[model samples]
Target: MSVRSTAFIPAVFKNLTFWVLIAIISGVLVGHFTPETGKGMKVVGDIFISIVKVFIAPIIFLTIVLGIGGMGDLRKVGRIGLKALLYFEVVTTFALGIGVAAAIIIRPGHISRAGLDINDASDYTSKAQQAFDWWEFFKTNITLQALILAIIVGIALNYFSQRERIVATLYKISGFVFKLLKLIMWLAPVGAFGGMAYTVGKFGLQSLLPLGKLMLTMYLTMAIFIFLILGAILRFYKIRIMDLIRYLKPELLIVLGTSSSEPALPNLIHKLERMGCSKPVVGLVVPTGYSFNLDGTSIYLSMSVIFLAQLYDVHLSFTQILTIVGLLMITSKGAAGVTGSGFVILASTMTAIHSIPMEGLGFIIGIDKFMSEARAVTNFMGNAVATIAISKNEGDFVDREHSLNIE
Candidate 1:
């Protein structure tokens, strides 16, 4: 065999994307044919997520510390953070509006509510009824906690005479952690396989048929948001959203399989830096954005609320619709750290409005996992775009020639 052919063979076999795609397909097939076996694969996915979570806190801490400390500009750090927050709010609001509009147009909930499975949503409803506590949010949110501590430590280190030494030490640690992450990422195919298999096995494809309209509307709204709203934003920067999406194809697939964006967080930060976004910008914006700028979650939350209203044949006035959007602006921000946060936020929003039945959550709970793929993927892409946009706006972005050269 020729050397080129041998090399090509190895490259194809070694590519992460290749394996992950294959895994996803295999998983679906397994789930469809042998659900019992497929359901067992959840452990594989859980282990992968646990392993990934182990690195998340340290990586965030190290990246933020290194980025901020290296920059030695406390003011710039604050400015970048503030700007990212403002951008997150405005864009997420737009997402909420789009979701509401799409839900109204599609009316995914206009069908019969009878025969829908009703699960216990009391936990989410009760939690939503309570006042949101910032301390509780920070305590539960590891990434946000890491971001805050890292920022404070980074700022303090800026004044330390041995800041460079500390930064260098942290850099080495960061490299080691990334190396470990690279090793762990090889399990992504396994993780994806397990996650997909479990989801399909447990829920079955037939499960999606009942709520298919809501799912379709959710996906459509996300696509529109990405192409129209986010695309226009990227165009303003003279960049192509398609190019960026293509660049992050691997990460997006990982999120697609896992149905959670958390797994892709570290890689997203790394990719943004490689794309010539400043380290400080990537570090500060990405982690913070994970918490504050959940465009997908915002959309899902808004659309779900409207769907519930329609499901129960409850007529919502324009004033009530605006009230839901307003309430979501605040509730959505709390989604960062909570598990099953989308539903929780939905529950909370419904509870607060007192118009939508909280029990309606039970109907959508079964298919939330499938829809989550869209939410996670969109949230992941939104943050990626936000990081680059903020970097460009701050004059910290470096236009690398190779950024457009995606394989």
Candidate 2:
């Protein structure tokens, strides 16, 4: 059956996106007028994100396990994983290059550093001083751990004599998890309100004036990457980028509101499956992409590096720029599943470069929260596109608009 359509009036009021938009506007007003009250609203957002996170591990485990178990092909599973990693590497490299190019052209760091705040960066800097280890990353990243475990369980189940029964049981559990997730999602507007309020309350809108150029550069660069680079990739696969985006509007709104993609992760999987992407492709790609395919974060980190060099009047040679790209190729994978990881990754990269002053990080701290929504949204879109592309590549996709009258 096709998705049911309601009359415009009832649709607008009942729509989650409409409420989220209103919440975001209300949050801005609250934060701008009464900063203390806005700051206090943080718990409302935090609790919502936390409640959503409760489903993440289980959903990842169940979905991936079920997908792979259904596939019953160990070799195909490995191939999809490899292809996904390869796609992530290539696209993120382009994202980094675009970021660096934009920063150089825009020259956002030309403003005086005297007005930039440097005190707030101490926490991220201290965290950056510690080395990044894959083992440590795997240990700390519950998502990665869940992904790996799911693959193993899925592969193991392929050989089980009663695999069909186990899969049937797991499918029922999966249905229950998603139903609960649907109910929990009604709190998204509240979460969005709290998130926006906390951000604006903590860092007032006036703060954007001083670093407006950098903020503009960031948003502009991401827009280019989304429309030009990512758009091309989707188009090449015979998929309309705008169509995919419009279809994902609700999840995108949730991500924009939360400034954290995790809240939308389950929904993305559910929606992609609804769009006729195979369970295996969505399950395998989405969680893996969260860690490896952070298009927005790559752009931000690359631009931040260049922005810092320009801010400090430190000239980066062509070779140094390449080195930054190469370094980020490795470092950006660590961006997911950690709080303030973007800053932490930036700090670590700067420390390794030893040319740009590590203190420059504090300069952008005021507006980082504002940019995070964009980062999360871009990352969310990148993962979705990746899933669809991979699904088509594996001959595993069906266009729901044609088959199920999804439109």
Candidate 3:
């Protein structure tokens, strides 16, 4: 028994999920016990995210170029793009409705805002007052920029006489990039630790207690959406949601610890491909979904608006509520993967409505960091589901035993 137990310990230590989970727990303890040191650890997480981000553009460019160029079918590319956009629109609309519905029913904002920090929201609110420009959003979002350039280059590559040779070379580079990504991923636990520590150290858990109801409401709503709405959709495709969640557990934990989905973007692309989603579908759908198909951000945006309205006792008519949903369908697209973007989008929506006091935002700002983990995880899961759905719809999904093999 002693020999068997000793052998099992090394296997447990080898799992990335186990390490990441331990890091998160350790971070919380540090933040709670030694706040100043935890706050300074923010640089660790930031540096890690910055390092991971370096690969995002090139990976996206190569993957899309290879996916489209290799396929040699512009028509199919157009078909997949159209289907993905349509899927994003339909699913996100439901997400918006669910968020708004949950907020109204629960009325989490119907509480005292005493002692909550409202001043921390100034930067986001100031940005929100600026008119949301679709052109600017596209210009500033590096992921979308990479995606557009890749699509154009991919289409151009198909018409090149020497396309096959160039694609072969690009494939070799792609292999190196993914290999490098595997090595970089070893730091995920460290990054997770820093991110969690910074959040808890800076905000302190006690500061968030007053808004526990809002936190609970948001979490429960997202859980329901994931298991019920997303699960039902996957069921129709004969895919199990639990299976996908289990497969993506490591990535999800990274998102949870980091409180940002961008950390998991590259891994999601690789994992979706490993799950038998065609390269083109994974490349095109995943990046596009980051900007346009933000299920969790949409939910957060809609819910925040309703929570604010209820907080101030502002009565929103059915028509106005519908209008809010319609507006959010556009505004939420601008949130992207940027930190504090959700707040900016929420502020913009509040500004446009002219009813809810923008100051109400201050009430929730302190707790947003804690809630971001939930949002990021949901967003990560949502994008994964989107990729799989589009792949299956295009008849590009292949279920294979080897699909589960990931280094």
Candidate 4:
């Protein structure tokens, strides 16, 4: 590593992990204690997230092209991409199963306000009453979607690497964008803390209490997802998941505070590459994986469906839940990566089930806001584990002794 790169090692440890946690906790506490302060802090968070989103298109395009191009043989890279996606789908279903089991067993987030009349989710009624046109939704999130399609087209075009100066130029552009992203990423702590403070100031801890049980359950489930399931995967890969976490401490901290996982993309790719995941596997899987294989989203989909089902006294049959799971599998394919997207998917999912009233979403929307931090964090961790596991399976992994020495 260069002197400049070596210098960042200490800061990544000191500021990224522990200090970021302190900032997040303080913001939540302050937001809980003083709602207005939380509100103020929210503005900081919003601005920060906005800044990150401003670059999403380039980040997705470049990193993906670079990861794909690094494979040398586009055909082999495509095959690896397919295999990685299949693995993602299988694991995502497992996540769905875990969520279903948890929801059925514990039935967390049941509001006990009997004889109390709550408004059906009116705010999202627009979303529900709107037509269920997959085509429109497809068109909406089409930036990355389109880029993936283009990559497919390029594969068919199969212009040799020498002739395809396009790929070379894109690789250079991708490198430049990643560098710019890194420079801007230095401000991540500021953005994260500001976002956390805003979340606290606006919502207050009281807001969290409404969905406290649900959030706590999700958090616990997320812990189980990490330590038990992902831990096992890490062990299978002969990699310490904890070690990976340490490598990614800075990125995960930023994801936690801001509640948007996109900002972590550059770091995740670099870390996976360092871990000896082949560039093609890391590049293609990580970017496209953002869309298709969201384990965290899968878990939340099942849990939230049940949460709303009981919240409004709508008892769903076993078959209905099976259908909900099916719908989540389809819906998750096009799930949004924005902050509070779970609720949007929740809004859409509830509509698809045709049992839960549209207005029912309001019961949890207030509290759902707080839960997304864990959701985003878990989503990120799931992808990181996937990259490592796939690399191990593909024989691309670096030795743990070399990668996990922590510099």
Candidate 5:
């Protein structure tokens, strides 16, 4: 609650972020030392992520449709919605460019030594090739075309949602999501333990070394996006962004534990309301933001693609690279901020750019986790910024409370 409270922490000097960092570090350490336990630990993280996931679809639907439908004059949203969407696009595209540039310059993943498992990954080549094989997965995940279908379904549901009979049904569906979230969170402790143990068991501490730059860069960039980009936007509304951050603490922690942002939707809703944002606005902006404003995934898709290309010494003409970037921008939007979303888009990106073989994915498979931290942070910052931007433009900006003001 207070900086003094953070000072009382036994594990680190202070702060919630520090504690989560410690938890992650400890998990990684424990997971690596005992690779035999990695399987079980991985399950913990997976289960935790799954628990939060059940809430995603319903939350997205209710939040967006209600937010929009509740807007009595839809035309009034033109300025807010369009401007907010524009911000998401510009910021996310810049992030992707930064990632690609970073990868090309650093070549962080390419310095494989003689004794390194350059050849061992041969066993993993097929596994890697699968990443670029978008067609095979498109059939299974339903994330591609089905994603648009979900919007259509949401639209249809909203039409019925207006009638009394359908309103009751829609509310019932929302209730189901709440129940699912509860059932899953009940198992979080077990899941957290398992996930952390798995990280420690599998790679131990050694894995962190290779991914150090990526982890640090991602974290630092996330901070910049929040304090600078998001902060500047919030300041325009004369609201303290850190106050918003504080309100969303619960959801943020849940995201950290599971590395999945979807699970935190309900909490985000509750926080936004408490901060004086109208319920309809929170519902509409947040869910739609999940799909359209995934700033983090944009960066990751490009960074990883560039990283992999460099890792394998693949050459890309400027025209070829620009095509990949443009294609990725389309494919990466609306990507869920979950463990596998980056991979999903990567698979699609490779398909679009025939230059890279599907098997090329295996090169960085071992390091995706490190890359994910960066991606998740970006996604989180983007949504938070979008909510504020929309609220300001809609004349719904509320300055109810202040919890932190580091800037």
Candidate 6:
């Protein structure tokens, strides 16, 4: 082969996507064969996630502050924030509706509930029984709290006479943080390997069969939401969803392996900017979306609720279903930073409705880890597409032709 042609091959092999793919395959093998050793690999993933998280707060603060400060229009910042929130609501509502519809149609929980392992869900139920206070939620949710503080600081900086100097310093720091992120991301394959190995090793494939129907239904619903709903929105903007997904493959893999969208947050912010989203839109929308726009989490929440209702043979009225969707719209926003937020939200939703048994959560907790990958991947992609759409709407997106060609 010509040297030029051979050079492309080496670059392909060196690509992060290539390594992530290999790591995922190797992880499955190790998990399936040496389950005990694979289980111990959890620390590798945890360490990588911790390292990535160390930069999240700073990066978000700088990105939003710089994005808002540099925009030179406080009204535009408010407009973008409002628009992003509105967009998140409409899309996530659609996600919840679709999830409920899919569960109703598929009837994943229509079978016998016998032979299901039931854990003590008293902890979840007890917490769920408590009233959901916005004050409490704000106090507990670190991401939402950071986002609010960043916006205040960003808006305050807009009026500061010395804003330029501070913004410039933040930009320098942003550069350093992102550069550090680049170094941290090279460990992605190791993290992916460890995360996947531990999950499969600890849970085992057999554990999934009992709840396989629910798992499959959730995945199917998210796939439809992404390719159909999100895709149509992107098409309206002259962008291909598949192309965007292809562009975001590495980050998606990281989310898949980690089963938490968080590990990829910093990298996603940088990539979105590179893909032509204006910094302000990327900063404001992405972090906010983590809290406000959880399409994947919304879908999972609704479907799981419906699945449990069906599992317990508890028939819900149309009013009850609508109530479930409405409650989810609020509860889902509080999901971002809470540990076991999914189960907690599910428990809370059931408690409020007084329909499904909170005890039913025990039936699926074993497989929750497996299902979380779907939620994380869908949530990650939903936020990415939202950033692009919002940027394009605000006339902040650039390099349309060139960015569309990103492979």
TM-score of each: 0.94, 0.94, 0.96, 0.89, 0.78, 0.94
lDDT string for model 4 (30-91, tens) is 76677676777766777776777767766666666656655567767767778887888898
Clash number by candidate, in order: 0, 0, 1, 15, 18, 0
Model 5 Cα lDDT, one tens digit per residue, 98-186: 66776677666565532233332454454434435446545654323434454455455545545455545656776677666655555
- Deviating ranges (above 4 Å) for candidate 4: 1-14, 114-121, 153-157, 161-168
lDDT of 1 by residue, 273-314 (tens): 888899888878888787889999999999998888888899
Better of 4 and 5 by lDDT: 4
Clashing pairs in 6: none
Clashing pairs in 1: none
lDDT of 3 by residue, 55-162 (tens): 888987888888889888999999998998999999999999999999988999888777687777787667767776778777777887888899999999999999
What candidate 2 gets wrong by more than 4 Å, as runs, is 1-8, 337-339, 402-407
Q: In candidate 1, which residue ranges exceed 4 Å CA deviation? A: 1-6, 119-134, 337-339
lDDT per residue for candidate 2 within 1-407, as digits (tens), equals 33555455677898888999999999989999999999998999899888988898999899889878977888898899899999999999999999999999989999865566767768876776666666877788788888889989999999999999999999999999999999999999999999989888987887668788898999999988888888888898877778888888888888988888988999899888988899988988998898889999999999999998998899999999999999999989888833356776777787788898777778877788888888988899999989989998989988655432342
Ten-residue stretch with the least lDDT total in model 4: 113-122
Error of 1 at 208 (Å): 1.8
Instruction: Give the alpha carbon lDDT tens digit for every residue of 1-407 in model 6.
Output: 89999999989888988898888888888998999988999998788777777777777778788878888799999999999989999999999999999999999988666556665455666777886777877787666767889999999998899988998888898898889889889998998899889888887787568788898988989999999999999999988899988888888888887788888888788889888999888988998888888899899999999998999999999998999999999888878732256777777677787767768778767777788888888889899999999999998888656774565
Error of 5 at 146 (Å): 9.2
Worst 10 residues of 2 by lDDT: 398-407
Task: Give the lowest summed-lDDT range of ten residues in model 1.
Answer: 113-122
Off by over 4 Å in 3: 1-3, 402-407
Name every residue pair that clashes in candidate 3. Answer: 118-362
- Return the lDDT, model 4, position 379: 82
What lDDT would each prediction earn against the true structure?
A: 0.86, 0.86, 0.87, 0.74, 0.63, 0.85
Model 4 error, position 160 (Å) = 3.4
Model 1: residue 142 alpha-carbon error in angstroms: 1.8
